[model samples]
Target: MVRAKSIDHGIPGRGSFMPMRDSIPRRADRDTLRRELGQNFLQDDRAVRNLVTHVEGDGRNVLEIGPGKGAITEELVRSFDTVTVVEMDPHWAAHVRRKFEGERVTVFQGDFLDFRIPRDIDTVVGNVPFGITTQILRSLLESTNWQSAALIVQWEVARKRAGRSGGSLLTTSWAPWYEFAVHDRVRASSFRPMPRVDGGVLTIRRRPQPLLPESASRAFQNFAEAVFTGPGRGLAEILRRHIPKRTYRSLADRHGIPDGGLPKDLTLTQWIALFQASQPGYAPGATGTRIPGQGGGAGGRDYDSEPNRAAVPGGRRYGPTRGGDPCAPRAQVRQTKGRQGARGSSYGRRTGR
Candidate 1:
């Protein structure tokens, strides 16, 4: 029988591409897949509850990216009024759909990246596929639809997004709009196939008072790219390319940012001050800023890519473009904290898409 893949998402091997093979899924045992992909799919019941507990569903619907085995989906339906899931594996998509037939869950069998995010989906929660974590996050950050997301991503990713030790290129690009925080750490043992790295719970909440206008996203993304990739060891020297040394010195004096601070050490406020001080005078068609390594040419990562049709896949869409590329969303949700996820064992199945 063609059983579903492991808990999280399939472990994709290095330099090895796993095709969706919607028409012909080769027969293989679960262990063989683990050996082939090195995937860490989430399956631990306690971990599932823990992951869901981080989501603050304030009377809004929840959209799950990859409801592998439906463990997290099960917990979500118990508290939220409407639950929507996108599973790429045909068998598991059918399986998850069957499990929640009567509940207030809407199961769509399709790639989350290609899927058209439904309107008014305020909260997005998932044990995301590790391979395309950055792409998936970029997709989410590009859209102004949802207000918050609670995700179980790679440990390093969690810390970086939360800006714990230091910020990453992606995190710095989005810092003006969202607030990232890292919660608990999930051990490798929590997964069925047991991935090599541990998972971390991360929460993303939109800022009520954005330092910059949403219209300036394109310019800001480019501005960030230049600063991060600038040719200097310290920010003071690097920023000299954008702003005059006199201005930077004055700002540093006022903000208390060390003159020798590295790019990673910049806080949100400091970054905003630097950008505003530059006074790029953003016009409608200003040079499109791209997220470094996320796009091409003079411009950076372009948010205006192919539109999401929200089409229903007849068969399963395995790993083929499983992430990246999502359209707008419906509404917003105010992330509510301190709510423990309710337990569930309805369908009783653990193996998932």
Candidate 2:
């Protein structure tokens, strides 16, 4: 059974006995603490509660990362059945244990990535380390046991993960495997030593069935690697060099897809079509019109036939032209040498006669 401990109210001014406010607990020295951890602590009590609320479990077993000075840890211990915190800094871990000795909090002094997740954790909640947030998240996803997670991360990362369409590959790939939502955006000032940028809380729940097949996982990894390296080019072009031409051509032809590749807005069906088309004997139609399930016609309306197609200057439509700007004033060529001598001679002879 977990024990409860009296929260150390070190603040002076308030009466000897005052109830702890759910607001952020003031830090003794925020700047120094921030310097130690390379980040500020989330001191807002309301934000902490909101984050904890997002966790779906009954809070029987919870994992907290980077529980700095027990800012969020204080509130978590009060609400949860058992809380295990992973703190890399030994000093902070010691302080946490001492501060919440009687409380139902266990402190593990190590990096979260290296530490083994405890068995049977119903929920995982924490303000993840900024330096290794993605690695930590990936680690969590790899673990099949946890029911859900609520994490406070860099606002940008959170936004990318929860954003609609054209998100990062990490976000998009994992999205199919998990449900991600933004709970709230915590202000930068909410921390003891405020961070330069604001942070946000993201709630992610595992999907019932994994999105990609085991065989496809490696392929997806390779695909993502290629796409990120050359984001502006067609997906097929980027992938062609890494994969076999036959495989690439088969995928494109079978889908009746253009070699130009998938657009940023390509749907899951389009992706599946490409996969299907990669099979043997796929022929893309010559008309270059995209027909659903037709395998090789262009998929969208052709812009090449648009009326009032802007003409290129110098009558050169597709390539470079031979002339200069048509709008500029033309320069007159002055007669020199022989022409000037002839004019002068005629005037001299007429004058002499």
Most accurate candidate by lDDT:
1
lDDT by residue (1-353, candidate 2, tens digit) is 56533222222221221223333324655446456456677888888888877778875878787887788787777677888787655556667877887788776665554444555576888887565677667556544456688999888778766754345555544443466877688998988667788889988886544433333333343344344455446776765655467765654565544667543444433443443333234343323223344344332223224335321111111111245321111112112212212111222122221
RMSD of 2: 26.1
Q: TM-score for every candidate vs. truth?
A: 0.71, 0.61
Give the Å shift of residue 101 in candidate 1: 1.6
Tell me the tens digit of each residue's lDDT in model 1 across 80-182: 8788787656556667766777777776654555455655687999888777677567656655556689999889889978988887667777776677999
C-alpha lDDT score of every prediction, in listed order: 0.62, 0.56
